[model samples]
Target: MDTRTRFAVSAALTLGLLAGCGDDAAPAGSAAGDPAPQATGEPWYDEVTPASASGTTGGAGSPCPVPVSFPLADGWTAKAIEPPKGELAELLGEALTKRGGTTARCEVDGRPAGGGFLRVWAADTPTVAPRAALEGFAAGSGETVSGQQFRDLRAGSFDVTEMTWLATNPLAEEEAARNWALAVQSAGQTLVFAVNEGLITERTDVLPAYRLAVRGLAAPG
Candidate 1:
């Protein structure tokens, strides 16, 4: 199978597990361990951190437009993308294609982890999401749902439902979770979409920041 196919399968499996937790109230993965350190004010992932010695760049911001109407924890920065086509998914696909990756839209789960369909881009060559790309990461990445709420948002002429997930990062669990959120909007035949890595992790310290970011999202008219 191709890399995209593999990602699809992995994403599906991961989402499936997340979907099974309905009203459990205990939060997924809490049993794995105690929460990590709580970030003060805004976490580093909310802002751009310079690259570390391991060569991993820290705190990359999304390429979406600035002053985008989304909730943010104190100190977190949010950017918005003004797509040329006015459709987020299409714009994301075009951006990925420009960077040598192939893109497609697929049905996503919309329950515990904020299930719904979303567009995913895959690349055999190096590519990055608009946010990561602007930050100079050379890796193939895509955005998907990962949290418990489906938020309605408006961007440009699109109406979108956004979801978040606590992404797992073996090395920087807190930082990873603080940076991921999946936002999707339907614009005619296309879905305007955005995903952040800071909000997609299982760290406790990051959950508050993730919640703050979710609260910051504004419905686009």
Candidate 2:
């Protein structure tokens, strides 16, 4: 699949590549004692180090008109995505950019770095609460979502509502993958910082980058 198509979330592409598609079993070749899913249903925290590099996005000179600015990890490139013109193109654009009740404004691509994307999605209504916005997003993601967990946390100076879950679609019904998003209110907008990948990589390779962004989340001052 093209990079753009692969980068589109589960709501946009049914391909089992990313954006929450899951697998029922771990990949075939396993070491003697690999970690398995926890009985408590918590997210499997991998042992990778947090990304050690950074650039910024979501400011005046940034590529996207996002509500917040955060670190872009090493090898990830951020891009502002414009809605397509013309009616028919607009329809497809909506599908590619919109999820639940929010629309993706920017994507921090990690494919070149051997990972997925850190997408910035925004809600239409500023009045929506962060938790509600996140719930709507999970429900509308067009995947068989399960093992959802939600919590409140502080990232930079902003209060964040974060959700993690396992999801899959018809194309990847057996390989349900873990995914996450964080919602925050900033600059009169409700924005979601999502770590989305659908590729067949061992251990979602972008989690360190996602964690880095979440750790540095800030309003676009």
Candidate 3:
């Protein structure tokens, strides 16, 4: 039980509640000057989100300060997240905020695109490789993770390790769900960008925007 992401298993129950949120219809309001959609043939899903770059985050003026900067899709928003404070909060924070050897730094809400989130998690270890960070992230899942497929993906000029896997939840109507994550490096930290398929959202709903951001990842140039 300690090996799984307890929170993820419980989240699957709400998947149906977010049904239809992943429609292939492209979101409007993308800035005309922003980068265009960069699609990948991998992780093949029926409808790719035609999300355009609304803006970017993680650089100086961005809402959330992270090790890396990535594009934000239209209809999505970004915000910084923090763990709870106080003595009792410290214990809860460990469970709520920290996972897979990383702490959540930025959360890109894709409710307009897919009811889920593209969360960025960062670790203190600057030298940690991408694969190891993703492994920790999967290990942190409360549900049973399997069918993991790992590969090399390019994010801007950087090389990243990407992983796609299936998570099982006994409580959900759809017992098996898909999830994706990628790890990249910055100055003194290892950052993991991931989207979990649960908690009122499905993979299809959020992946378009996720892919857009992943393809747009950069070293805050």
**Top candidate when judged by lDDT against the true structure:** 2
Q: Could you give candidate 1's per-residue lDDT for residues 1-221 as a string of tens digits? A: 23344345435433431112331222332221222222233322223221111111012243222222333333332222222344664544344333223332222222233322222222222223332322212123342213332233332333333333333433332333323333332221222232333223333434444434333334332
Q: Tell me the TM-score of each prediction against the true structure.
A: 0.27, 0.77, 0.74
Tens digits of per-residue lDDT for model 2, 159-203: 777777777765542567678798988878898888754665534
User: Once model 1 is optimally superposed onto the true structure by TM-score, how far is the C-alpha of residue 170 displaced, in angstroms?
Assistant: 12
Error of 2 at 118 (Å): 1.5
Instruction: Give the least accurate 10-residue stretch of model 2, judged by summed lDDT.
Output: 30-39
Candidate 3 lDDT, 1-221, residue by residue in tens: 32144445223212211111121222232222223323333343524764688888886557668767888888788877655567875675566667778887767877655556777888756578888888888877666777776656556756777777777765545566678897888776788988866556766668778878887777886
Choose the strongest candidate by TM-score. Answer: 2
Q: Model 3 residue 12 lDDT?
A: 23
lDDT of the candidates, in the order given:
0.30, 0.68, 0.66
Model 2, C-alpha of 158: deviation from truth (Å): 1.1
Candidate 1: global Cα-lDDT?
Answer: 0.30
